[model samples]
Target: MRVTVSQPTRRGTRRSHGVRAPAPTVASMTRLLPVLATAAVLLAACTSDAETPASSGCDPALAAWADAGFSGAIAITAGGETVCEEGYGDANTALTVFAIGSVTKAFTAAAIYDLVDSGALVTSDRVGDLLPELRGPVRDATLMQLMTHTSGLNGSAGADHQPLWRADAIAAIGAMPLAFAPGTDHVYSNAAYTLLALVVEEVSDSTYREHAMTRILDGFASAGFWDGAPAAVGPRAVGHLDDGSTGEAGDFAGPHWALDGNGGLAMSMPDLAAWTHALFTGGVVSVESAAAIADPVVDLGDGAAETPGWVARDASAYGEPFLAAAGGGGDVGHDTMVVWIPSEERVVAVASNGGDVSAEELMAAVGPALAAGDPIPAPDAPGGTVDPDVAAAIVGDYRLDTGGAYRVSDDDGLRIAALGADAVEVLFPPRDAAAADAVRTHERAVADLLAGETPAGREELAALEDEFGPVGGAEPAGTIVADGELRTYATLATGDGPLLVWYALDDEGAVSAVEAGAQPPALDLVTDGDAFRPADPAGTGPDVTVSFAAGVLTVTGPDGAVTAQRD
Candidate 1:
């Protein structure tokens, strides 16, 4: 049996095939004078025979970050006292606003819990009960299922490049077939959260943004919804791409309002720190609701737990209970992570503008130090080399279940083209003429380029630039081992920011899968003379193998064999 799974598209020009959300400093305040004075006296006494007294600030980890070329803001709070608060490079914690990406989900989830507390909604209520117009399997899903991404709904309704009315988007999502039976498995669905946001609007009789502003961010400083418009807010740090280019928050592609419930919040590091603090301290929601947000409701079976809005991991590293939420924009920019240690009443929030550093790395380096209130050593750099043989075998054509063919070319270091509608359309259906035209142009350009017609392809690419903006070329980034698979990363520069492409190979070293913009159909077999064998057979139908002849590919698995022709 051929099983099709819906994959969520990362918003922005660079799409990540893998699910990795991608990380700071400081301090001076008159209020700390008393503490500083006392510390100075104690330090002087201890160092009476020494030449200098120890500094009052106790964050060597933060100082180390500045030394490591970190270019963002960081805020750390412990026991209701501001432990470390500082900015690095171009970031200013007091003024520079950064897009928090999916971290917005936390605020949305908190709002839902608040509604439940107010007797306006319930976790058990079916989606159909709240939004009667939502049809199909999704209608039978409970709000809790939606919150935990177990709604069985498609991972995404589609991307939002064109202007899409929320009502119409909801209806379109309702029309999509469920990936599986509701509540049976785990699939991250931004569409589910978007629907939940609609539920919030219906229940509160206000827009999702409005509700969030009033209920979630009313008291926070310098935070607001990012509607994909140019930054009207000043002092905003532009997101940096892998190509060393910069663009305002809205410069990245994708629908802004459409990502509202799932992602779309922009704020400063201090504001995010404040929000997390308020969230866990019963300031935004009741203590019970807050606790529920951290409680793991779904076991991903990968040692990761999914809560309403946070991802929970083992507390062994922190030596206490820990919860973290992360968000990123497409591939190489605007990454943020917030970590909460409930037992210690500690919160660590980090935000970076470029992909050079990741929140996970920052947290890993700082978590131990923050927990111990002393700086620890920095962790090793992430990345490694791909097997030369594995890299050579991964060049070919792949058919996507969502209706497209991904062509991987080894001509000049692995370039790719989408034969039909690119994956972007699968998640974000074109709602306007411009979006539709762009999609067509992209398809045509890829086709021409794959055929080795550089001039014509470049012409089409130029047209795309005219429609969009300056498009950057793709370059090799690096490689890493994920889930026991060695995947290569490539960076694509766009008007918005840098996007990364992840290519996965099968056991036999064939290009078994490619995830960029949207999920492509997995490649199961590669031609070996006249015969073909399973490449990545795990989680597939059967172990049977077959042969290819007469320009047709025949695949036989346990269930049986099927024949398909090149498109």
Candidate 2:
């Protein structure tokens, strides 16, 4: 899928790219600001559990977070006992409420399953049965397809700039063509789940919030739909950007109700823990319904499977089987995750308001340690130098087969520039005046393509080469790959770090496919800022060695190395 620039909102909205904004007062904070002085004293006395040491089962996970300087709250349970409950960094209390983002889907999913258990609906029911207004192929989508994100709906249909009623949102969804045939493929769609929320309302004859409150949150905890107006909840944590920069208190804003069913849920760690406990223990739904909620009916192709609300996969730390669910939002500057090991009755929930670090990384670090029941050693820090000769071979201007060119320079470390109007518009979104105009021009071209004015979209894109000249700007910090194929990694000028540009060479050594923003997983390499180095100094990976031989420069890894011929 092509990557698109995402916009920010007052309420947390899920987006692929992080959105930077001046901090706004969150709903919870706004509601509690008047009572802050009094709440601080009462909260301090009530939060002693937040400092409790992890039981033997959770000690390693706690240690891992400590080692990584993680700023978050964590709660771990084993065999129905609390093994660890703690907070770190700015998230110094268990009562810190986090914008749980997509994790809200779990609650929404559970509500759907609850209705199923009550005989109000079934996974096999066609969505059209519930709402007759839905048009096109989407009407044929099963409840199961929506649960597993295979409903053929677009992941998102632009931004929800203002609050929208369920009917309005459904109408918008019905107007868009299906991205693909329903049930044929898995494409994550927040809109599909939002439709599920509408289904819940239609069957239960209750608002989505009312159904969720009574069925999912009532007995467990007081977490509710974030309506932008704070209810009487506990203290709220300030959200920080991914770079560890905190937004100002003045920036806390209200909820974006339009994101209902897909995201926009918030709660403290304890409440989150309670919610997890209820779902796994059949407290919220019957054992049979809970099982169905995590049945792994669809393969996600990444060694993971999708249940209604969770991703079933091998635990990264021990390769043990576990069900995991995660949610993150750049707009809210928060990430949250829950891991449930059914066999062991173990649950680990982590939530972070800081944007600089990902909850997934924190979970990955904690999972193995928790599973091992021992602290896993941290990977070695990155430090090494790329050979100048190897770097020189890959540094040059190469024209993209599609159109335009990119220049790689070794002048100040390695960097790449998106040259020409078309490439710049594709690689970078509208940020400044010239780039904004380019985007507008590109949008007009897209309108022409959509109108069938050109034989193909590619033709319109190629026509740009004649109409516009090159626009150049360099991204700092680049890595040259000399393994099997030549590739380079560099930070984009937009501040999103490390996009890989790959070059496929023909038999004559001419660059064949100049694909940009294609990155494979890192091989035994520890990344520190923009640089990479062998995770194990003594490891035998081919990437640990760089050599020049037979007119080729190679940066080798264990299985393979990227190589480029000397000019």
Against the true structure, whose lDDT is highest?
Answer: 1
lDDT of 2 at 405: 52
Clash pairs of candidate 1? 14-499, 23-359, 158-427, 158-428, 159-427, 159-428, 251-496, 400-521
Tens-digit lDDT track for model 2 on 1-567?
Answer: 011111221222224211111111111101111111221222222223333344432333344444344567777665656665777767877667777767788888999999988999988999988988876678899999998878887544324334565667778777756767888976566678778888998899687778887887776454764445333266666777522345423223422435677776778766776677778889899999888887878875444577887777644423456676666543455667666767656666777776223444444333333333444345233345556875676566555444545454566454344444333333333224542443343334333432335443233223322332221223422222121122222222223333333222221121212233433222333333333433332121223333345554344444345444444
Question: Best by TM-score, which number?
Answer: 2
Model 1 alpha-carbon miss at residue 70, Å: 1.8
lDDT of 1 by residue, 22-65 (tens): 10000000011111122222222222232221242334444455
For every candidate in turn, the CA RMSD to the true structure comes to 16.3, 13.3
